[model samples]
Structures are given as structure tokens and as C-alpha cells.
Target: MRAAVVISPLASAVLAGCVVSQTQGGAEHLAAPDGAVYEGVDTRLLDGELVNFVVAMRGARGPDDVTAYAECAAAQYALIRGYGFARQVRTTVDEKNGAWTGDAVYTISPALPRGTRTIDAEVVVAACRENGIPTV
Candidate 1:
């Protein structure tokens, strides 16, 4: 069974100054909770199985939303490449006056990382789908 991803009230609460998250491509495109438009996930393949992912939500989205969106994107992207697992190398999340973004670098592999906050790609993809987040 796959775990479900739930958006917390605090994460979903968007003020007039903030844009809300919305569906796109069968999933959310990093939309702002306040209904402001934002960028979708951008997955950049790097050397030796590494990937750089960027997800942007407009209108001062929350940090949790940023992380959730990024994770969902990573899982989908990994599956798209026929991978079974992924490990986060680093992540930088920022929320400014009108934007919340998650910039992450990860390594995809057939097995999970020995340590650290590694993630199982298929499991995550399933979770995302269960939560209505689109997978690649």
C-alpha cells in the first residue's frame, strides 16, 4: 500500500497576497494557493544519474507546499526515466513576497541510498497519484 499525501491547512491557506496551487498536466504545476500562476517542475538531467529539479509556486506559498511539490515531481521524473529509487542530495527552499520555490538535486538509482533522507521512487509516485498529484 502507498501512503497518501495530504495538504495541511496551514499549507493550503492562501491569503490575497498569495496564489493557490492548481492542477496541470494531470497534476499541480506548482500553483500558488492564492491562485497566482507559477512555473511547473523543471527536471534537468545531470552527470552520473543526478537530477536537478525546480518547482515554483506563485504568491508566497508555504515551505511545506514547496517540498511536497518538489518531491512529487522527483518521484514522477524518476519513474519516467525507468528508475526505481532516488536520494536527495540537497534542497534549497525559498519563499519571497510573491513566490515559493524548491530547488533540489537528487541521485536516481535501482536501490535506495544507504543513508540520509532517501526515498523510494515507485512508492512516492504511487503516493502522489493517490493524492491526485500527477506522475510522469
Candidate 2:
């Protein structure tokens, strides 16, 4: 002789909920394949010819995306200030709650700055616009 076991409908529903909830609140669920979503840029003049840019975004693949956003802002800011070039000083990137932020600094000059990371303001701004990154 054999005994048969049965699960009630209510118990089955509770078991299903437990399995589904295990995959929630993970980084993979927050990431998007369509690419990063640019948020905004904030440019501040720290000193004469020295500018600081704070940029934020979502769905960034890594720190590179955040850095690029900050660089784009610095380039546009240089042009707005009547400068033709900018040299990257440094950039600090951070991620929290699936949002990325970059704090970058650059020096603007009318002449091409003496650095390997120098950027032509006009060229950078054009690229930024093409790439759909916001600038200040």
C-alpha cells in the first residue's frame, strides 16, 4: 500500500512567491542593455582657468561612461568661457544605487594645453552632442 500526498492551492502559491522573490534586488536586474542614460552636468569654476565638473548618469557600463560625461561637460564649459582647449586634471568616479557620478577637474586655456590629455573644445563639444551626452 502507498500513501498519496497533496499540496493545497494556497501553499503552492506561497512556494512560487518565495522562488520569484529570490531574484529581486540584484545588480543584473538594474542594468540595461540599451546603453547608458545621461542625466545632467554641473560645471563649477574652482579657480582662474580651473574648472570642476560633476556629472551623473544611469545604466553606465563602468567608470568610463561616467568619465566621458564629465569630460564632455568640461569641453563645453571651456568653449563657453572663450577658451579653445582643456587639459584633464583628474576624475573621481563613484556608483551608488545603480547611478554613476563623476567628479572631474580640468584647466582651460586659449592655446592648446601642454598635456597628452588635452582636448580641443570645439571638437569635444561636437562629439558630445553626437553621442547625446549633456554639457554645461
Candidate 3:
């Protein structure tokens, strides 16, 4: 009976972890993909095909985590807006108040933007999935 009880709690813990979603944490100011908390933003509306979304996350996150999360959001946003690609304009990652934040500008277009850091819709989506990163 004791063994059975121990096994029951262990199974519950494992199941609990499995149930956590990709976009579960949003305790920050602006939410991002994965458990990255949204810190804040400075997004703007430029033209119909060009948009910039500056986002942040609250945590002891690294530059890679913040950038990847921002890219994931940008890529997903493009897809949601009926665009197939996003051209990365600039990315600024900083640490503030012990929180890691990233500011990125992406140009949404029906086709890939003319940039080396441009993100392809299908490619980014697949990368996010494979890496367990969440998308907007």
C-alpha cells in the first residue's frame, strides 16, 4: 500500500509537468512564447506590411532565450496577419531590474524580407515546435 501511494504521487508530478503549456507564463508586462514573462513593449504601426513589436520578459533569462522568444512571437504574428515571412530590422536585448528583456523590430511581408536575419514562417514555426518554444 505504501509503494502504491508513492507511485501515485510520482505519476501525478510527472503528469503535472506534461500539462504545462508552451505559453503558460505571462506574469510580465508583455507576454511572449514559452514560459518567458512579458515585461513591456514599444510597438508601432508603420505601413500595412511593416510592423515593429518591441517586447520584453521578466526573469533571469539569457540573451538567447529573450531573442528566441521575441523571434517566435514575431514569426507567429506574421503568420497570423496572413504574411509568410518577417524581416528582422533590429534586436536589442537588455537587463533591467534583474529582468531580461528584448526589443525587436520585424517587417511583416507576404514574402521573405531582404535580410540575413529574416525569419521564414514555415522555418520559424518548425524551429519553435522542435525547440519547445511557444508562438504568439
User: What TM-score does each of the candidates earn?
Assistant: 0.66, 0.72, 0.63
Q: Write the per-residue lDDT of candidate 3 for residues 1-136, one digit (tens) a residue.
A: 3222111111122334432223322112122234556555555667877666666676534565676666777778888888888766776778867687777777888965564555566666655555555666
Backbone-clash count (model 2): 0
lDDT of 1 by residue, 8-62 (tens): 2212322222334444211233332455454788888888789998988765345
Name the candidate, 1 or 2, with the larger TM-score value: 2
RMSD of 1: 9.1
Q: By TM-score, rank the candidates, best first.
A: 2, 1, 3
Query: Which candidate should be chosen as best, given TM-score against the real structure?
Result: 2
lDDT-best of 1 and 3: 1
Overall lDDT per candidate, in order of appearance: 0.61, 0.67, 0.58
Please, what are the lDDT tens digits per residue for candidate 2 over residues 1-136?
7433322111222334421111221111111225778888887889999998998899887776677677778878888889988888888989999999989999999987775567777766665565566678
For model 2, the run of ten residues with the poorest summed lDDT = 19-28
lDDT of 1 at 18: 36
- On the 0 to 100 scale, the lDDT of residue 65 in model 1 is 57
